[model samples]
Target: MSGSGSIITVLDMFGARLPGDLAFSLSQCGSISADHPLAGEIAAALGGKAASLPYPRRQDFMWVTLAPTAEQLRCVIEDLRCWVLPSFGWESSPPIVSDGGPAGRMGALLLAQSPQGYFRWHSRPADTDHVIARLATMRAVIAQAPARLSQLRPTLEMLRRQFTLGLATGDRDMALQAIDEIDQRQLDTASNALSMSIRVAAAFGDDQAIVDHPQLDNLLSMRVPQRVIESVLLAHHAVFLADLEAAGDIKAALAAYLPLHDRLSGLAGHPADDADTGIVRMAAYDAALAEDARRLHLLADRFAGDTVVAALVASPPPIAPLPILEPAGQPAPETEAQSVEPAFGEPLQPSVAELETVRVAPVAVTAEPALPLGWSDVPALVATSAREPLAALLQHAALMPDACDPGDGDFLIELLTDSEIIADTKKRAQADQVLTTVIDAYVCEERFPRRERLGLYETVLDIWSSSRALSTDPIDGQLLLTMADALLRLNGHLEAAVATMITRWWEARPVRSRLAWLGEALELLTEQSSAQDYLGLWYAGAGLINVDHEGFSVADRYLWYRLGRRLGLDGTATDEALGVDWLPLHSADDPLLAAGFRKIAIVSLHERAAREAAAQIEDRTQAHVVLVTDHAAGEGTASAATADVILFVWGAAKHAVYRAFDKVRDRLEYVQGTGSASIVRALERRVRAAGG
Candidate 1:
């Protein structure tokens, strides 16, 4: 009688069999988690003697409750397939019913994230849509946890991220709907619900719901450390409708936190002494200017370039000016890339000054039809950034006219980089449009306006220079390089040109063939001008220090911290003298690496860098020296925390890369684009978050 289905099917199949959700409604049953009351019932149903275990299903089916471990599931499969089902004379494994396998797995993961659940079932995306649906439900449950349980919201919120909303279709509707249902259910004397009605409401697409919660504002107003702002943001969302009061609380809470993105925490020589706060108050004074640029963009105003320039003082770390200079890579072929194509739009005379007149101004009174209505106009967050001719860009590039020459390609490339086009931060699912434009240009080896590209690069540099710009915003910074790399690689010059454009900070090549090739490219760079190349290498390597020391295992992370040691290894007396002061090597259990490494790691490393401020024994182990990362965000981004370590016992987790890779290969292959499979796979490995 076992089966998986809608809420009705679950009640029909397991109402008498289990205790939790169904049992509460059915009177005779009261001991199982709602998502899977019959995990044990079904497992026991495999035989018929399953009535042995107690009811109210252990709170959760995955980790905290009734869920089977991956190994147990494997055992179940084998037992049923080989032994149990065979007794019934079945030749094949019985297909176990489930409500979206990945979604179930996601629930299990969410439960395990906190002390909420006692078990976890690790699995891969067998069915993506199911997983997506389940994830929506899980996030709703997690968002509601804090109010129901008191203060576990931040921790659960962190865990919530483990399951990708699988929405890039990043729609708010699914998440919002699930959140609403969870809120509707009351956990009274008969309802054993760990109710956080305030939390469930936090999942609303509107941030104000959280801020308007009856009790959320007061709870959020408490001054936690400056590091926990995101948590505060999450908690404050629980606060309900009187937004001005909530906004006042937010501003106050922010003030009490006292740490700015630029505040240097571990300052020595009488900090908190009150007399000298101003001395170092403006130490990185220029960062204020950078913040000026940030504030403007957030407000959608035109921040003057000099404001950005003043905020950004350091000359860009002498990056090699992409020596090729031309995106076309090859010599003048009188082809689409090299020669001017004056036929379409306007002539390409290299003057980007026309931007003042043509670029979309922040205060433009009239919205042109070319511009799709967006955040300002729409009542909802419709992702309009790349909706502009997105699908066309891909087709145009993918099916480049075999007969077209330089003019057409130039016109297309130049048009794509226009200020209005480039500045659009449309939601990612929609980004395919802009990227398609870039990709097509690459496919046809078309040269864009070099001046525009350089200007954008300079602006990016300015934005990032003063902690105000935020290099950690993944999609904007490194991912851009990845996309850029894909385009260059498509044109075949990706090899000779990439290393010059991207910092060595990002080493995305995991699929060996690609790494071997990138290695070959680096070789060319080294050969081009040995000394200058080495300097570039060292300069690039400098970007790696104390990165993300927390998230990785001791050994894997140690490899990165030893950057200085890797440099000058060839015994060059000259290379040795350059003497880079790499952040000291840290072990996983080291005082700094694991020492509550999870808390405030990013800001400590990048923003309010208090070098030794929060360093503690990372692992409680007796091991000396902890392993740290080159990018604190690296550990978080890489998902090092969730990566499984190989286990010998059924209870232990495994960090089986091969097994993991095998599980997701099909999904990767399915999502990969034409003629660009290798590059796409390489990037998915790098940017799809860490443990994933």
Candidate 2:
């Protein structure tokens, strides 16, 4: 074959008629002679003389070259044995080679052509060991190559399918699986495609994309590192958590599978790995839920919402029983002042360690000194204290049947002066007032109807004992001795029993430090069938101090309110118990409201006062009366901004309630105190000024 550029130029003349059939014997020679058998025909094919045949080289057999013609030139090797030579008719036999045609050096190449194709097999001189080793190595590689390729085919196919599914549907799991498979199979192209899809999903915040999906959080536990996608997934996780937080799915947001913020922060500023970040995430989620549950429980406990039973169960009343007080020289542990007095006094009381050591002992009874009239010696009363004899003197003085009993009134004064224990000046004065009221109740029949004898005794005794036992102020302790004496005179036997107990509690330690003694006292009073009105008043007082005051953190306001309700106080009595004096003033409408007031705001520190004022204002006028207190911060602001007239209470108001009236000073047309006249006069003055 001959070619030009990439094209083949074939000239077929093998079957064409020649000048003649020539036969020749082949030999390895450098010359072709005219005497050669085929020389004439070759010369004729070339259209030249016989001398034109060229001798190119000596071959193993023969090599021939035709001289260049005007048209074409060529070279060829002829196997004279295989060449068809003109021969006589019948002899057909295999020729035996004498020298195997022309043996040459072993370096000589043997080129062979066959119908199949050209083949070249090379062999170089080597030692026997070298050849054998080279063949063995080749054999090993050839044996394993096919198996390795076959093993990876299924894996590559799976990766391709995963990649296809990831692209078609925004399925992050499929995409991640595909990426994982590609990594395992070393399929670089498929991994790149899946990674690109992740990038798109992350960019758009696609819900099902590998980077944005919640399942991406699982990467924290994955063993194989996902270096390229990890950072993107972390960022997307942060965004998702923030969204949940903004939507107020607090639990779900905290439940996020990764510490995404910490992870991203680590990436930017530190170098925390997934394992550390996962531990932090778990800790944060647990802490968040714990804190939330704690706050909710605290709020519930404090507010008492619908959780009355729960509150009672969680904090049982009276805490533990009061430890029994021993006699003198065998003192019990010191009690925290917070334990005996109401919670409102907790901040004011001395700490347990700071309180003075006081011991409880029964009063010494010597032979009674010359007894006064109607004050015969009683052993228990005398043994209690020398002052107990004087209390008996006052009790008789109060009940003496004289229209103007100077003896009874003077008798109370003697008791106050005779007792060395009546030390606090204010407490002594309060006791004097209480004794005078009781004695005067009998002396003047007019004041007798107004006398709250038992109430007066309880209130004064409570104040005096509180001053002596719980006072943080610079006050004398002797006042409690005076109070116990006064309680004995007022209630007689009942007062004596309670006074003894009070003296014991004063010297003993309380088991439940946060509970007030009043809770226990109320139980005793109730069981003893004491007056309901007195019990109601006690409940109201304790309730207010324990909840509404600055010292306590627990909620006892509603609890006491409910307990007081059980006492069945009438409207007037309930008002008295709550320390409000608006009933007499509430009988008629305020004159100002009758003078065409459109809206009247009654602002009080207490809820009951506000409620009472609202009722009175409604009764008197067509104006709408809004009750404003500290609890009604919203209502206060609303009414103060819009009301036509404000009845500013300057009496018994807490600072909190006063602070709520900042916007309503201009419309304040009336000012009232704790009395009925102050309220009525203020309203009347406003009416007169308005020409009503």
Candidate 3:
């Protein structure tokens, strides 16, 4: 064979016929001697005299110019083990060649071929060192090569093969190195890598390898093939139990084994899907199942006195085989040249340029008006007359409560506290008259229901608190306090609105009187209220404590203790709630205690806050927490849809940002606060409310 682009031209000048003997030699040896009868025929094909022509060596030239018959090409390929390409009269444009002989050329060809071909060739037994060296060379080539669509599948295959061979030969360093490389590459083959790693780790009986693998969490978080996950987890557990048993730690071994036994027993009773129909392609999977069964039998014999294990061992779940997926086909080329031959008499379709010239009428679109950022900007019903404007507004509100806009409450409060109205004696008198009229209508049993009155109370609290008024007038303070008391008593459920309003009211109160008022409000809470209500009240009180500004004071501690007792919690809960190092309340019967959600996706724009929240929830509940910091990112929608519960940090996220999770709205719960403690509290309340 020759190097790239080398060609040897041959021409049939004499066109002499070959005799039977020379034909047989040509067929057998794939060559002819200069003295043979057909040598002149071969020489003539090279456009040379027989005696003057030099004999060609098989390895000397990359491409021979002779036009060989089909039989001769077959002889060269089968007998000589050389690849032969018959030029279809296109010698002037031969295929691109790599630098090497037939075998090297063949290897390069395999590399350029589809992923399936590459994998098939590399999987064959070879010198381990040679394979590794070749892989290293290929890595460099791949790294330097322009990233083409055609190279993706083949590259993934190469990495996978490296990982496989490394593990097979007990070169853990090599295996781990391959894994590290895969991570560094940041390709879309993470699932494949995870699956391969899990299988190899299980096969090698290295439970720690699987358990401690960096990608283990990813394997758990991602939606890999169900059969693969189940099989790998089972194998991992079995290996761990075996190791424990061997070390004479029977108790630890039993603790690990019993749960798996119970799970299998439950699965046996349920028998989800057809166990007979499920088939896995991995021999290691089948081996793991058998090994686990044997281990379980051994455990049953060793711990014969244990009724639970005996019962579980008596009937085991059938190990279902899952069908193995075939290797994925190579992706289609990104672009392909197509030659379009026009039909003899067919009319041509309009070209893109021609179509672009044709104009289409624009369709009218009626877009919905955007909502205002704050309630103050929204338009509300205007008073019919400028005179007695406050009174007219109140009258209209009372008459049309159902038709009243959300901004009406804000507008009403604006009029009540307007500087011009409050400063002017006559205007203040008119505002007071309208305010009394509205309060009377609000408090009336027949006119405003309890829910409507609660809403009005929340509106007043929100507006007044946001105004940051420093009015020390006894009547003004008392009026707000009285409304807060009524709102708390009237609201049966734990509403976020109530919590927010209470917090705001506490924040707006005089510093000297705030704690006293909050303590009295806490005292007024009835035992009939849910723990959620108590927590909501505590959240409001805690908002005003400002432990970060001033160290946890005696009064703050006492307040937290009081709030804790109301929630049926102890001093530990109080301590946690009071300090920065907080822990979620745990009890044997607490709904959030051991709440086994597989995943909880927390979506927030605040990265640090989201991470803190995830850490707290994960620690408390022992559940996987997928922190989606950017709502618009790739994983947000998937996490939202897959998580058992989605805790959206309402305060940290924007309205438009969270619309991506609209499809999973039913699973979504708006967390009222962004702090870790608040997120954990929200999770607890949500779990309790769902009776989890």
Output the better candidate (2/3) by lDDT: 3
Taking the tens digit of each residue's C-alpha lDDT, what string does model 2 give over 127-221?
22232243334334444655434344545544544443342222335556766667776766443444444443432233234544454434332
lDDT of 1 by residue, 33-64 (tens): 44553344433333322111222233322111
Prediction 1 global C-alpha lDDT: 0.28
List the RMSD of every prediction in angstroms. Answer: 30.2, 48.8, 39.8
Residue 126 CA displacement from its true place in model 1, Å: 73
Model 3 TM-score on a 0 to 1 scale? 0.26
Best by lDDT: 3
Ranking by TM-score: 3, 1, 2
* Residue 115 error, candidate 1, Å: 38
* Model 3 stretches with alpha carbons more than 4 Å out: 1-463, 466-589, 631-633, 656-659
Cα deviation at 601, candidate 1, in Å, is: 27
- Count of backbone collisions within predicted model 1: 77
